[model samples]
Target: MPDVTKAIASDIFSGRYPAGSSLPTENELGVEYGVSRTVIREALKVLAAKGLVLSRPRVGTVVCNEDDWNIIDPQVLAWHAPHALDDKLFDAILET
Candidate 1:
């Protein structure tokens, strides 16, 4: 579960699924990862609590903007930095 959460977190931070983009449904993710929807939802809850994602009714889960991200969190910044190659994102992360 932790591995899945971290992988999902890394994917979100990497912009594999950009802000405002809907992620795979819990069921889809569960099938892809060979986990249950319960585990997927719990992982997503962790991300949401970390301000890395927004889960809304009918909209699914979406990555949050930089402003919405927990930039002050070293773990979050570190997660985002290595995967983010864009100059703008790098600058933003550094600035934070």
Candidate 2:
């Protein structure tokens, strides 16, 4: 479950799942990760708690803006890829 959560977070940090973009449905992610929808659901919850994503009433899980991310969170920092420190992240680091 943690692996799935980290993989999705990595994708987001890598720009593969950009902010304002909706992530695939739980079923789709389940298929892609070979896990059950329940696992995907839990993973999404973790991402949401980290401020990396949010659940919309009509839409599915959507990635939040970079500003909304809890960059100070150790787990979130750990999730970022080695070369993912873009301008926004650099600014975030400076701000902190």
Candidate 3:
């Protein structure tokens, strides 16, 4: 479950899934990843909890703005560190 979430988060942070983009349906993701919908749902739940995605009942999962992400999440920090290039989150913390 953790691995699945990490991979998806990597895809998002790496620009494979830009903000405002809707993620594939759970069934599609399951097929794409060779997993079950249960796993995809769990992964999506993790993403939603991190504020990286918004999961609506009918709209599926949509990537949220980077500003809304949980900077404290280790995975989120790791993903941002390299992809952000400017280390914006690190700069923010240093400024604080």
Against the true structure, candidate 3 reaches a TM-score of: 0.88
Question: Candidate 2 has which clashing residue pairs, if any?
Answer: none
Per-residue lDDT of candidate 1, residues 1-96 (tens digit) = 877887888888777888888899999999988999999999999888788889999888988886687765666666666775567656675786
The per-candidate count of clashes, in order, stands at 0, 0, 0
- lDDT digits (tens) for residues 1-96 of candidate 3: 887888899889888999999999998889888899999999999899999999998888999998898876777777667767557687656765
C-alpha RMSD for every candidate:
2.4, 1.4, 1.6
Model 1 lDDT at residue 13: 75
Order candidates by lDDT, high to low. Answer: 2, 3, 1
- Residue 39 of model 2 has an lDDT of 97
Error of 3 at 64 (Å): 0.2
Worst 10 contiguous positions by lDDT, candidate 2: 81-90
Looking at model 3, which ten-residue stretch has the lowest summed lDDT? 79-88
Off-target runs (Cα >4 Å) in candidate 2 are: none
Q: Residue 15 of model 3: what lDDT? A: 85
RMSD of 2: 1.4
TM-score of each: 0.79, 0.89, 0.88
- Tell me the deviation in Å of residue 49 in model 2: 0.8
Q: Tens digit of lDDT per residue, candidate 2, span 54-93?
A: 9988888999998898987888988984647778777787
Can you give the lDDT of residue 5 in candidate 2? 95
